[model samples]
Target: MTRSPATPLPPPGERRRLREAGALTRDQLAERVGVRPATVRAWESGRSTPRGRSGEAYARLLAGLAGAEGGTGEDGARASAPEHSEHSGHSGHPGHHDRRDRQKAGAMAMAMAMVTVRPDRRGGGTAGPEPSAFVQTPPPSALPSDAPDAAADLTPAQAFDALYSFCAPALVRQAYLLTGRRDLARQSVERAFQLAWDRWPEVARDPDPAGWVRAAAYEWALSPWHRFLRRHRQPEPPPPDEDDRALLDVLLHLPPPYRRTLVLYDGVGLGLPETAAETEATTRAAAGRLLHARETVAARLPDLSDPRELHQRLAELASTGRLRSAAPPAVRGGSERRARFWTRAAIAFTVALIGATTLTLRTAPTRYEPPVPPGETVQGVPPPVAPGPLSEEERELRARLRAEFPGGPERLTPQAR
Candidate 1:
């Protein structure tokens, strides 16, 4: 009889996890690994095993799934009961539980520190209440339906989804323009959303959530981490697909300010006023930036008929994952392992500039100096006034006054008097 073709086997990792969880049946494992049931039986019997990339990928997926289901012994698995209690203290001593709680609290504090939002540049125009006050306010158990205001009804999750859907794409596009790298764009956008999630209620209530997200993205893009990456690391360009190449060329060639302005106006669809508000510029200045941006793009890509087409193309590139192939500029290794060195450098630079400017202003001479008279003395004594060269009428009046009163001549005092 002719021999049947050999069957593929399940990934080692997956098979191991499944066995540990008591969930593995030969037939089921075989189906999962794309092999015949007999092949799975042979492998479980130690007669054969799967190998290579496909096996590895299958193993990783199975292990991840098993971990999610609380299985033990998988690489990604939750700890066994004893290990869990030892570390997490779900069933251990009270001190262990307290320590775990404190550890969790510290981790949360550190995460919050990573993406701290600076004070709004516009002062208190739209940032809502201070953080301390907001923290004290209790969150409602459930969001009220039929609430008249959109802001009042929005939950953190809903707000995040809204901003993600509305703002993330625009931010990603802007980041692409700035860095000419899709991964950086996506990361920048995601980081911005992560930040938005932290301040969801406040951001949700703001008049322009999109603008707020864009500003957050810009802040992240210009952050010290980003700057360091740009300076010390070089990002590899995306694969040379036609759409990818075209988009990259268009963005990379744009002057930095024009690229920023265009992305804010065209990609994000912010009006001049809103863009100006987010960028902390005047409306007229924003308009000028947009006008210049359009002109620049039009000049470079004259073959393109519509400005809207560029945005559409970017959207397409993003959706197809063409843009995500580029790697982020690496800043993972070096002196500041946990904190990015560039961020520290930027903070130092800003502080130094402020100090220098303050010192200069303090020491500089006043612009408006008082005028000094030619011969007048302003020291200790009062200045002498010279006698007037009188007109004929004034002399005649003086003579008449002297004749009218004998004391008039004495009244007309000497020049030095």
Candidate 2:
């Protein structure tokens, strides 16, 4: 018995043709296409038609199968037919098919480029650039306003879990960038998440929960204790071997306010207004701080002429953890000891002054009598009375008499009588 010739599959027909011809099983096709078996069934049953690149892929798959079986090329045989061939007219010409394939490939390339061009989410430890460097253009379909409240009425643990899942790594990175200390970064991020957990309802209601957490991390980084600790602790500089040492040295010279402003603006690519919002300063003040910071850094690192180049360098340094190891010590041990001694001396002087003030206040005179004129009498003496009720005229005369002799009736009485 001779084997029958395999059925000639129609060009760009339903995926069922492959199933019937045994070119590919449903599972095999689904696996190759990276889709579920249910999707394969959908294509084969003609519930919906594949379009664009998907359709092209299907057509290519069919053409390869036909070529393998020693059949005429799907398009070659069709091309020799009448110009208005009924089968090929409505669908599209071979040239059109090739164009579509090219378009599909172009789109895929663009998508892959976008993915590859994106910044590294996990710092330079893995690969790629910093995530902040990417221009995040959110899709219109990604409107958070329409998203279900994933964080609504959640318990503290649940809220924290969600926050950690969404924000912890980003927060850690921001903290590390701001503080340039891994331990501090971890502390800052953890504290920020704790605070968010404490106020989840309010945080969940915010327009941007991630932004809120980021702001919190910044605040934690700027706290007085953190500042004090940074001042007192002599953190080792970033490796002197790194190329970014010059930049790090310049940044270390910047005053805290200026450094923070510059980092938020240049390192984070935030606008002046946004930096102001983040730093809790006025826009003009933020701009001035940033300007001063850049000026200081530029003066220190003249090699970094361009502000953008400096920013990129700093970002890379931060990503690589080389920036922290490159920082110059803020102050020497001798100077720190002198500062502590002066601080103690000032405290002692303040205590002495307070004691002296208290003693002076307690031992001062208690009497507060007012001085009297030479002729004035004390309250002890009884006042003299008029002999009788006087008319208005008599009252006026008595007043004049009193004015003339302040001793009053005593002076008017007969002498010694």
Candidate 3:
């Protein structure tokens, strides 16, 4: 027995045409099929192709419309003989299938490109190149308007875990690009998130909590401590591809600020002002660094001069090195960790201060007091002076006298005075 050939899912344009022909609004169709409007939009825009139940449902709808219009039915059965024969040549055309496949691939590429073109933080149109396919770029969706107040209800540990889960991978990827070492990059992200965990109350309440984490991650990745540590470790071999190795080598050789600017601007898709804020530089400085970085890369790789090509190449570089999400360092309660860190520091400081004070008191100079004989009423007295210059014979005589009689000097010392 032979299985029948599966029905082909309609192309995005065909699906749109069917919807228009049936006079069904996008939302209506989406609701009928139990999917979000966005999913329907994605189908129409060729950003996604439906599958399984959704695919069957779409095929059924199109077939029903085609049957009513006196054309092909669900099983590709033609209602009119002449029309079927006329379109028969088009149906078996292999070239036509290839063209459709290319269109679908192009659509998919365009969709993937839009994922990086985020809406402006200030609620503006999508920033970056004009997307080949249209996507509704909504405002940066926060944790809802009520999320800020609700976030406070969560314990610091819970808040931190949430932030870490949401933000760590992207942070790690950004860090990885900034520092050419994966271990250092991961350490940097973990350090930054740990810092965020410590300050969750402030971060959770901020307008853009993700921004805070990104800034911290970028700074930690580019810090001197990492650089110093990196010097002692054996350098890893270059990346696999020549282009990747050359680009990364050039990036590593750039000034730290420039490298960060490039990562933020190109790698992270941040605007100049935002990149500047993250890098702790003025907008003009960030722009200059970005321009310089691009020029440097272009000078080395001439193919990257085109803005579209440069953006695409940089995006590819960033994506190729993306780190798989790893289990984060165990999160202690943010409040507890912070309290413990500071508490330990304070205790150490206090112990050091007390020890210092005690040591100082013990070693300090004191007044010199002459010993008094027991039961003797001693008066303060001046010491007696000997003659200005004694002859060697006299010194020998005085020494001999002192040796013979212990009290001789006291008895004879006043005679010279």
Candidate 4:
């Protein structure tokens, strides 16, 4: 209990996403948020959290970005990148405002994540081909050509819709990959959104609102408890394509942590650190999981020995289903109802507990009173003495009495009168 509850914020990964979604250079964002660029870097890298006034400013900034990005949900997923790749240009070495995030993961991750070794048939490692293309993380759009220009100006409902429209579609696909069940995936996204709706202010102001919901959805989708549910005990139908089925099977074969890391990094295109943050893992741990996952997949389906192939296959597999999201109104309403019900239940429980305590207090003895001994049969009273051999004198007296009064002693009953 000594450990305080963790402050709710977008994990380090989300800080980077918010930065990218806004299409602002870290420096520009820092300038506006009133912090140094290095601090911003630190925030994004999971090195530190924003603290005090500066943190508030940063939160406000992120809130603005989240709001803005949520507005452009429809046209958002067209993640654009420069066509020709120079290692240096892709290095994302600072100095550009309007450029969409060069890489959601940053240059170092791009370098470290590019090529993973392939395991040969003998289980030894060899160099393998890299992923074909780096799929950028999708930014939930907050602006559109036809809609209002500023996201901050929008109403709460509108903002929630924007956030949902931006995240729900892709989130469903991602959830399907995690759960390997379309229904579960849909439920997970809906459930996550409902929770988000309940905590709308926190989520709306978060640096990466999408990432917040995403983490929740992933957690729910991958929960071990789901296996106990009758509906989820049996597996759902597989993807239609033969390749997709095999890929999904391979994915499902891995442990949940490894699978989540792979999907977040390879499938979702999160950078190494970002993936680690989102998965609540250390960078090294995330790397190990990712590496192991890739090895396992490659070993099982040699065609995907390259991480790139796995990434592409993951996207394809996730995209194959009809994992649609429920409407914003329904989700929001459900959230409100659930919140109210739980609140009432908690209040009732508290009232009942207090009443029981009050009754016990009232009836309980005020002073310490020793327990009374249990009643036992009285002792020391002699048992009825049967006739015993009479003493000489008593026997003589009895004889005399018997001689004097030949009749035995008479007993009389009371007359009715």
Best-matching candidate per TM-score: 4
Candidate order by decreasing TM-score = 4, 3, 2, 1
State the TM-score for model 3: 0.52
- Model 4: per-residue Cα lDDT over 232-322, one tens digit each: 8786888765667888888888999999999887777667778899999999999999999998988888878866556656755765676
lDDT accuracy of residue 403 in candidate 1:
80
Worst 10 residues of 1 by lDDT: 129-138
- For each of the candidates, give the backbone clash count: 0, 5, 0, 8
| lDDT, candidate 2, 168-269, per-residue tens | 554565565566667776667666656665576787667656667777877887666865665438775563334556666676567767877877666755
Off by over 4 Å in 3: 1-124, 127-153, 230-232, 325-342, 359-417
lDDT of 1 by residue, 35-151 (tens): 654454444445565455435544554555555566334743443445544544433343333443443333333222222232333454333211220011112222222122333
After superposing candidate 1, which stretches have Cα over 4 Å from the reference?
1-158, 223-225, 230-232, 317-417
Q: Provide the TM-score for each candidate, comma-separated.
A: 0.38, 0.41, 0.52, 0.58
Once all C-alphas are superposed, what RMSD does model 2 give against the true structure?
Answer: 25.3
Off by over 4 Å in 2: 1-162, 227-234, 322-417
The local distance difference test score of model 2 is: 0.56
